[model samples]
Target: MANVNTAPSWHAPHAGFIRVLVGLFTVAALVVIAMTLAYPGPDPHTIVLVSAGISLVALNIVAFTLPWGRLPRRHTFWLALAQLVITILLAGTLYQTNNAIPLLALIPVLWIAFQLDWPHTIAIIVALGLGCIAFWLIVEPMPSRPRVIVAISVFYFVVASLAILTQANADALRRSRAIAEEAWRSQQDALASAESNAAVMRAIAHGVDAAVFFASQDRSSTFANQRAQELGRRMGVSAQDPTWAGHEVYGPDRVTPIPPEDQLLPRALQGEYATESLQWVGEPGAQHAVSVSSLPAVTEAGEQVGAVIVAHDITNLVEALHAAESFSATVAHELRTPLTSIVGYLDLLETDDLDETGREFLRRAQQGVTSLSAKLRELLEPFEVAGASPTFSFIDVVDLLRRRVNHWRESAGTRGIVIEGPDGSSRLQVPLDRELAERMVDAVLSNAVKFSASGGRIEVAVDTHENSARITVTDHGLGMTREETRHAFERFYRAPTAIRRALPGFGLGLATALSIAQAHGGTIRLESAAGAGTTAIVEISLTQVGVAARGSS
Candidate 1:
């Protein structure tokens, strides 16, 4: 860096200031010459020369006062040349009177060289040389005048050349230094910006409701956010420690500690990315159920440099899942036991000594019992997510959608709502378990109607394909926020709006729909915003359904 204080008080003169000073010097010379001629009664040659000299000095002063701003910058070159001519004429006169050496002729040459470029400087130098030679030839001189003039000219030429060259290098150096300084300032700004961004990221991590920790590959350094540090303290160790203190990390059972070798940080540092490694942290009362995900920090060249772990407290989510499962198991168990007895009674009631109507009623009752039993077992099972996928069969999905839309019309009519869909004989055969597929379709439709405002409208479209199908259900409903949409398919995860409205639901509808779709190798997504409405997009694959159907069969 350059020090600003190095510049001296006596700075170099500006070109305009130098011109004014030159004018003033001429005025002083004219005053002294006029005073000296006052006593000599002034000879005619000398008198005419002094008069010409006075006019020249007056012209120079007039130039010094010229409104240079209105003039072209190039006019300065002409001005300096004009002064050079006047100086030479006056110098020749002054020489005649007192044999004075004319040093004033060098001023304009230095002025041009200092303020202008190489071309102007060269012109000034050449003009000065020609003027000096002409002056010598015009004046009466004795004894080897040519040799004397040549030696004096050579000396002035060397000094002027060196001075002009030095000025050019100084200008170039100043320009280069300015560019370097600008580049340095830009680099400094970029570095400061990077640090500011880094600080913001750290603050976000610290404020988040999760534990974030990182460890270097060499295990020489570690970074941890507030939550991570808090968790570490509860577990009797610092988060910076690569290894946990004792067996503080418990498995999903929450009773047994995980092995040291199976720990998250250790494995992650060794290039293992452990995703969704749910574990219990801290002791008993203070224990938190956390879903830990460890990612190996890798370079573009595929080398792992270190590892980072992010863990969120999912204690409430886990507890809710368990409670819902327990309730489902209890309901299924109670209903199944009573249904078995009802089936036995229906079988015993069947007899030949019955009227045709009575026998038909008995058969219908038995069929109802069988169907109800199967539905309870499949839908209410606590471990349904882990169970085998239902069997698939060829079904007209378009017809199914048309019928479903009609079925919901009655329920919608109760709230002055309208449900619309395909009406004509549109046939699309897709390999899907009819009951399971219907359940999934019903779940989305139910939510559409249940969450919709009174007098809302729903548009259902069934797009047909040879090997797939897409069902889009758009409803003008009390829509969900981004957070709600993200966790909409989480089992027993209800939106805050639904809870606030006291909506009657177990929050299992969309969750069940998601499971069924995924089991059939399909995709389901919801698009919604608060008070805007919801659009549920469901796409099912015929190929995946075909494979599942064949495998089950």
Candidate 2:
């Protein structure tokens, strides 16, 4: 911000006001000259002096109004001095007649003081004072009175003081006015910027579907968006009280009161960052599950100022989880009772009394029962998969995969789907949990058969790459879009295409397969496109904790 004011250099402090004052002085001088010219019996000397005074008045007008900046800097002092000389001579000539004519000297002295610096101003004042005194002694008869002498001295002193004081006050006032105007403009700019930022923040806080709020350290000031205000009222916070308190907050259990020290807002204000601290607010019958997260507001110097808190309504998610737990409990109790009775009966029917074919069928029935038990256990494992560790056994991966493919063939054939396999009889030994590996394979193979069109082909392969085993299962059938494929392995996330086609599935197949693969220190991924097909690859690491090295087959 440099001052870029383009006003001309000739522009004076209060230029218009100065012009008005000078104009008045010119008019007054003209009236005096006119009065002198109109005298019925004017002397020739007086007549000549009146004409000279008129000419000087006209010159004074031009000098005062001209743009002094058009001339050189030196010309200013000379021109100002010339104007003062004219004023002095004209006043001296007319003083004997008008007596009051000496007052006109004030015009030039004041102008010089206003337009020039102190040194030049002092010179002009001294010259005007000497000229007036000289005219008083030489131009007219002296009234030898002590009162007249004292009055002249006092008048000159007062005039000089008035000029100096007026100029100083004028300069100070101009400077103050300029500063005030600049400050006003700066305040306007700051106010507009602050308002614009507030508008953007309002949109962001309200645009999102979450409850957002802010508060000062002492809880004396606060801000909350529309949703937060609604949530606040619902949480039993009074409209008049501070948003920080006036409500009872409970933990996720919806029964235990959350102590003030453990609460999200209190902790954050105390300079802690707390995230996803679940709270149940409002009365028991009308409570809502809110996941509140908080961060301490701090200055650049790391001094804690206040707190910022965001809350999300997790009522649906919490309710869904509760329902799932209850449903699992009910299903487990009902199914296990009948399953136990069936196992007891099967054990009582001894295969020792049966023929070879009967014993073979009996053996198959027992295996099917064992598989059902394994399926139940797999279903429950997902609830605790993140912390579950696999118990590894040195097992042949190829054999296990081949057996799974063989077992799935009959079921796949009912839809005319044919299964392929890893080429040749090769043993690829890897450390793995045997039953979990079989379950992972079964999940992938089942999905391949279920989604494939009639007579569609499937390929299963297990290969040794470096020190790891890779299992790939590919099917030529309906596939999925990129968006759908991204989330297809999330539990219960059936693809839109699958759901539209009325496919029978819980969308749990790939999720289960993925969990088991990761448990074995492996990864499962799919490459898919709509109407093209899908290829699922499961890769397992050869190394495992506490397991000795096994050779590749």
lDDT of each: 0.75, 0.74
Indicate the worst ten consecutive residues by lDDT in candidate 1.
2-11
lDDT, candidate 1, equals 0.75
Model 2 worst lDDT window (10 residues): 544-553
Could you tell me the TM-score of candidate 2? 0.50
- How many clashing residue pairs are found in candidate 2? 0
Candidate 2 segments exceeding 4 Å error: 1-16, 23-89, 95-187, 218-220, 239-243, 299-304, 354-364, 375-553
The best candidate in terms of lDDT: 1
Instruction: For model 1, name the residue pairs that clash.
Output: none
The TM-scores, one per candidate, come to: 0.53, 0.50
For model 1, residues 1-553, the per-residue Cα lDDT tens digits are 2333233322244546656755665774585467547644445545755666676677677777776655654567776776666656556555545544356655666666666677888777777777766566545355446665775577467646754775587568657756777666666666667777778988998988899988789877778998988777755564455564435778888888888778786678777787888888888777888898999877799987788989888989888878878877788788988999999988888888889999999989988998788667544732564475678888888888888889999989999999988755777787887877887888889889989999999998888555668889999889999999999987767899999999867677888888888878797999999999999988888788788888877
Pairs that clash in candidate 2: none
